[model samples]
Target chain A: MKLTVTIAGVELKNPIMTASGTFGSGRDFEPYTDLNKIGCVVVKGVASREWAGNPPPRIVETYGGMINAIGLQNPGIDVFCKEDIPFLRQFDTKIGVNISGKTIDEYVEVAERLASEDVDLLELNISCPNVKEGGVAFGVDPFMAALVTGAVKKVARQPLIVKLSPNVTDITTIAKAVEDGGADAVSLINTLIGSRIDIHKQKFILSTRQGGLSGPAIKPVAIRMVYEVANAVNLPVIGMGGIMSGEDAVEFMMAGANAIAVGTANLLDPAATMNILAELETFMRNKQIEDVNDIVGVVNKAAISP
Target chain B: MNQSINRSRTVCKIISNRPLVDQVFEIILACPEIVKKVRPGQFINLYCRHSGRLLPRPISVCEVDLRNGHLHLIYAILGKGTEEFSGYKAGETMEIMGPFGNGFNLDSSDGNYLIIGGGVGTPPMVELCKQLKGKKTIVAGFRDNPYLVDRLKQYGDVYITTDNGSAGFKGHVVEFIEQRGLKGTIYACGPAPMLQGIQAYAKKHGLQAYLSLEERMGCGFGACVGCVTKVVADTDTGWRYKKVCKDGPVFDAGEVLFP
Candidate 1:
């Protein structure tokens, strides 16, 4: 049997979701994927207001990864609901809107507006740092996470999933605060803050100077954080970071995440999500696993008597 | 836009790889899948065979012999990627990841089509001309001789300008456009300075112009967001940033926010 997951009473065919911003508007990846087969698609983060994003030099490539300070450039929620959502409706898969707000009121207001729309879930991205404030602010502090999650929960009748940032010192403390504030579920491991200087240019590659680091370089860190957060909260945890293959996705599932999201891998291959799904099925079949859920957090191992 | 294009890496053989000019290579790869659907102004990200090569390099598809399933890439030896590529022999193979990036809009409804190119920018213009298939005038600029004269015949109604006057008109491509009283839609690609010159002249004459920008890119797709160019717009999203590899390597000339 296939793995199934429920978020706020909505059934997802699988437990894998594409992280926001990595997958362009759903239309870009639809050709590479059978949308109905995947569990969900997280659209690019839609700020309460449209964002122009950072200036040029917004991205720098590290050895195995990249850093981007795109500053949440997006068409606002209103445009998303009006212009973008219609396309998502055509896909049989669940559509999750990743939202960012610069202020508490903005979060509540956007949530209230989105409640009327047909989004299956709301992924509150409170970790974007390149913006004026709200992103990293809400994500870094326990109090801020609670306040923002609570504010959105008040107006949002739909399922709310707070996406946690990896920049925090204590991710569990922040995750606990959001859970306390009434968030239904949570996703862990947004990009870590990083920057690279072009020594030859004698300047930062990104116009913003600093951006979020992601890709295979951050996978181990993400797995650790997801394990920590899953241990801290009862909510279903969505895990991601440096996930390039289906085997990588299975590793995250074994690391204690209920579901996984693929981010940087999508950059290398637009058909990454579908490719991962196929690889996961093949792994499950080869391992003689009847259901995917049986492998989720199947990391308990007895010490070998050497 | 319902275009379903994306990126991939294919191990392709170098059918015929040779230098077109000093340090400029004309590499023909046997990539059947990529060659079949390639349009003008589109490019490929080639992974060079060296650890020192940091990322894949972008080279515009200069020509495509579709019937033969061959794609030609024209590039100059500027970095490790191209430098390493210069060493590869015909029949040797390398991983080619592309036919990535949006190309020029092929619509030629406007009567008088004007094209401007400088250096390597001339390659994409060749493809654009093939697509235009209309009455279009080309104003090509190069820095020196031999190079300008060698490729001038490929364009239609060509106006040539060389910095040293070793070629046709002794001025810039933009100067030639102004001197010739050029009009209608303009499509251009070149170094930033030349593009800036063309954009200014086009804006002054109220001509619709599209420019293909060359920005240093890491991932030649939307994923890295490395190749973003700012555009002037009238909305809250004051800056319109499009991925050169995803949304376009070609965009309206006036849309570019000249940096």
Candidate 2:
């Protein structure tokens, strides 16, 4: 069975990759599972300079998932290149570095810096909802999103994947915008802007009063958006948001995603990617499917007929 | 730090899950792997099987019976996750990831050890008092109806205080310590207000104190970087984020900013 899927000229052993921000350079999870077994490990979002992030309580549990306003805290690019990259290079799996910034210049600088690095892919994060500056700013507007994508694509040596925000009304418009600007691929849906109030305290649960919602609760919305973006753009689509099982990954593939990244599920189970990979393989073997790519965009047309 | 990084994850069977008071409960797990490595202030990220509750609950190690291979976890039903844990019964096995985070630093000091705890924070102190070598005095504060007094008594001189004066002292635990004029190396785990109060008292009396902080955790290991506490950095205008899970659930009272 062929599990390998190529995205923007980079060949992954499998289509399974850990979503950015959820898997932190694969260090802490080394004890629970081997990093090489999975297709790729996308490290946490890193900026040109260190960000202190927000103050606690930054995370809160909702009904089917959790909300986080982490503000993309990370050790600057120098530290990441020196420490994180070498550590990740020891593993056999491909490495995808998730890059974020407050301004267009900052994004370009980060892309330029990682251009000479050992990473296989660069995921430009223009859609982080927690931060006040730069995150949702570039994401909410199609022109700004395309501008940032074009700027990064000019300097990035590795293939660039623009992570899309779900806060906007029309996601396909933004996907097409990034595609028009020369983006190698696009990943969605980042996180929906959400909030929860503490009834007894009469205050917001998150310190920031709002956060990005991720987990099982957001899976259906993610699938629908992925389907839309996949049909709208020529660029390869990486679908995410609340993927918990191998079957869920398969569903994303059916929705026309070339690959799937597991985010909140990693926080729930440290070995989630490995388990999902095993389950995906088992599913293929059981169904007598030889190539995994055969199932991509295989959803029945009549199912969604009005 | 590197040695502590790869500590094993275990699926241990629950021996008992019973309530101690109105909202608090004690859970004993039959996992020798985790019991062998746990220290006074260390914690375990307990996985809950309930639907929709994905994150693991970070519960401090209350006690460790090495002989019987039982790890004790004392936690309160603060939210939906703990509420699910409250329903867990004996014979059910759950996956636990820790023995993570740095425990209380056991130094060879020349003073007496004053162990203080408030509310749900009292659990970790049970193990600390039991392991300390020198003179120990345990002071526990509760809103009302104290539990685990007998277990604490085995380690040190136990002092209890409740909000309604139903127990040993009438007021807060910090006030009780001040009233007794106890001066020694202090260790504490409690609500932010209580820890802040203790920090002030420790500064006034010039006593060395260690405090355990609680934050909403993601990975329960250092990876997520979700559980961060502000600390003094080396620069002039200095405050940087440190992982509460990796750097500490316990930090020196002098270095930590309670706000």
Candidate 3:
């Protein structure tokens, strides 16, 4: 009957957390779902200074997914500490702030600013493709990823969780690199780079011409990457990408994710995280499973006979 | 600037869905709760059950019939989302959220008001026309066939135009307004070009105006920040991104940047 799992020393009542950028500090979704029920609330990416983001037409829908180039638009860290932290403190859930910047210094400054803040965890965003600067640069290479992870870990008062990019050739190398760099935990598969073109206009749908693809279409790729990273690294893994239901969370857990995040599904429905958590609890009861942790990486625990 | 407290998504029964013009259709949902709360210019996000389409379609409230508790919506087929909506029939259900977005700022109800709509943008003006307390005139422009004129006529003096000269006038909405020498506090919604023309014209004539805008959106709530529009900001860049879903599908015409 227990659903508790700790992510990097932070004790969460359950393993359910809203993916950063999709939950927006829980202000807009306050009416849609109960924040108290969730285990953790991960706010969107914030930088040391405000980012204007890309021009209009930032998102476009494809077959089973959507692509976005929001460019990590935010009101900056000062605004987050003053506004978001106080609002989230009113909730019963643990707070995880997603931090991003165009340079290593900018990223470190943001983490340092939140060093004395009330956040429970800090998720470093190094995979945003819409921006022209440091995010993709630091994430695509293992050495750069480790460097940023180490730099932020030095200043961050809260436990640091490095969010990884799926655009690289090998995700495991980056996972292990961060582990060696002193990262408390690692969250993976932050959107695959993709694009959509308008046949009639003969132009790209996104203003940036390319964006991160998310939703159900990218689930298979996310699952494969989560499985690989979970096996390669000893650090606890937070798996995400195209998770829409309780079954989706279970699938990620089976693939070695200590916890799973609800991202694109929140865009589909504001209350999706709650519905998913409810379904996950229902799944546990139905299966007669006593501990939720018993199911983590269950697929890898029992390999198929080759 | 925030949503009405404790808003929940509702699966309303589809009362009716039928084509109004070649590609445009009118749908009615049997939800009394939404009927009681919606204001002109507020929108609802319609969720598609199709697995491929994750983002909900935010459509403006065309009409709110409180007596019958029926909410009317008008949409034109543009892509797979609308194409799928076009096929929705009665006896079925739809998942919808909101009455979101700060509704139109209704002020000086007795003042002169001009409501303009271009193509698909005209639908939201119907409810605006009904609620305005001032002397109101509606100017709606269409590409070809003009639908919703009948409903619009019930609330105000309705002016119509079509590109093919199939309706009341043969010119565009702005051209018709200029030709007729009409000036007032204007409210509008339309394509980028049409909205830009209105914003320019309003500024030249020293008139205050409000406009409804559309953008490609992810989470039709504030969270995604994917559907942003350029707005006048006090920052060094002189502008910043505002969520079209949460901040607006409506903004002061002067503050919105056409570029």
Lowest-lDDT window of 10 residues in candidate 3 chain A? A297-306
Summarize candidate 2's per-residue lDDT along A216-300 as a digit string, tens digits.
9999999999999999989888999899888999999999999999998878777788888888898999999999888888874
Root mean square deviation (Cα) for candidate 3 = 2.6
How do the residues B132-194 of candidate 2 rate in per-residue lDDT, one tens digit apiece? Answer: 888889999999999999999998899999999998899999889888888789999998889
The model with the greater lDDT, 1 or 2, is 2
Candidate 2: RMSD to truth: 3.1
Residue pairs with colliding backbones in model 3 are: none
Chain B superposition TM-score per model: 0.91, 0.94, 0.94
Candidate with best lDDT? 2
Candidate numbers, best TM-score first, in rank order: 3, 2, 1
Off by over 4 Å in 2: A300-306, B1-9
Clashes of each: 2, 0, 0
Model 1, B156-235: lDDT tens digits are 78877888898888878888888888887898888888889888998899888888888867568665566778877787
Best by the TM-score measure? 3
Error of 2 at B56 (Å): 1.6
What share of the reference contacts survives in each candidate? 0.22, 0.54, 0.80
Candidate 2 lDDT: 0.89
User: Per-residue lDDT for A103-146 in model 1, tens only?
Assistant: 99988888898988988899999987677688988899999899
